[model samples]
Target: MKHYLRPEGSPPVNGYSHAVAFSGTSVAVSGQVPVDAEGRIVGEGDPEGQLRQVFVNLRTALAAAGAGMADIAKLTVFLTDLADLGAFRKVRDEFIDVERPPACSLVQVVGLVHPAFRVEIEALAVLPVESVQPG
Candidate 1:
């Protein structure tokens, strides 16, 4: 279970909540870059493509931890260019539920460890014990 918060007087958040609360096993995922399982770089210069791949990578990591995007309570996005914020959000809506969007922070970075990468995102997800049942 999760609860989202939006302060009474704070300015409206366009795509995210002010805070989120959850109880259960929490999983912290590493910042995901646009790379395939083979470690091959993807979407080298396209922010939209890169952002999409980043989400794909995030989903894979979450699945490994017995969670999914719907279980995420918070997210931190790192971008080399803020100009891509619109595109980033567009692709995000395709994966995350806008009605119960998680608390998020997007930061502009000078660079990532990889020159071809333009976006990276890390997420925190809370999973109920039942969700961890063995397959």
Candidate 2:
């Protein structure tokens, strides 16, 4: 169960809500990079490919915590280059709901720990009691 909020005075968000509210157990997914379960990087010099791997990692993290993409209330996206914003949205919508998207914060940074990583994402999710067990 979740509710999206767009305060009257707030600027409209294109791909996400201004705020979200939900009542349930919460889980924090640490910033996920392009690396996979075996610690091998998937994409290099490819923002879209890196983004896909990032979302996959995010999904895995949520699953481990007894939650899924639909349960996410908020997301923080980091990219070294803002030019890929359009590309990011295209791939992100594949995983998250377009109508009931989570609140989001996207930002550009100088660089990530690894030069190959162009995108990283972290999420805060709320899980319903019957949906899953504890991690």
Candidate 3:
């Protein structure tokens, strides 16, 4: 994938690319909340901890689809509070490639599926054509 961190005439970006260009088998992961496999919320009233769990869920979903964090081309992040943006970036850098980050859109929503949830993330990834096999 080609990451345009700052396209011509575009303003600077903090931790995401302005655009990403890629061609392959698309994988769409559903919005992942801060829940464990057993359906228990991982973090209670902690933004950073909740964000970590969300990333874990995202990783699991991506792996199930034969993709990894590096293959992600886009991300849609939802946060209940904008104040947690710092924590979000810190946790996000742990999962994604900081040098070649994916295109991202962040929204500060009034609430999520659960009031206890502080963060949710969905991803769009592309598996290289060569990596895909006929089924």
Top-TM-score candidate index = 3
Model 2 TM-score is 0.91
What are the Cα lDDT values of the candidates?
Answer: 0.89, 0.89, 0.95
Q: After superposition, how far is residue 58 of candidate 2 from its true place, in Å?
A: 0.5
lDDT of 1 by residue, 25-110 (tens): 88999999999899988888888888889999999999998899999999999999999999899999999999899999999999
Q: Candidate 2 on 3-81: residue-level lDDT in tens? A: 5657789887788988897877889999999998899998788888889999999999998887889999999999999
- Tell me the tens digit of each residue's lDDT in model 3 across 1-135: 999999999998999999999999999999999999999999899998999999999999999888999999999999999999999999999999999999999999999989899999999999999999676
Winning candidate number (lDDT): 3
Which portions of model 3 show Cα errors greater than 4 Å? none
Q: What is candidate 2's CA lDDT for residue 80?
A: 97
Return the lDDT, model 1, position 105.
95
Q: How do the predictions measure up, each by TM-score?
A: 0.93, 0.91, 0.98
Evaluate residue 28 in candidate 2 and report its C-alpha lDDT on the 0 to 100 scale.
92
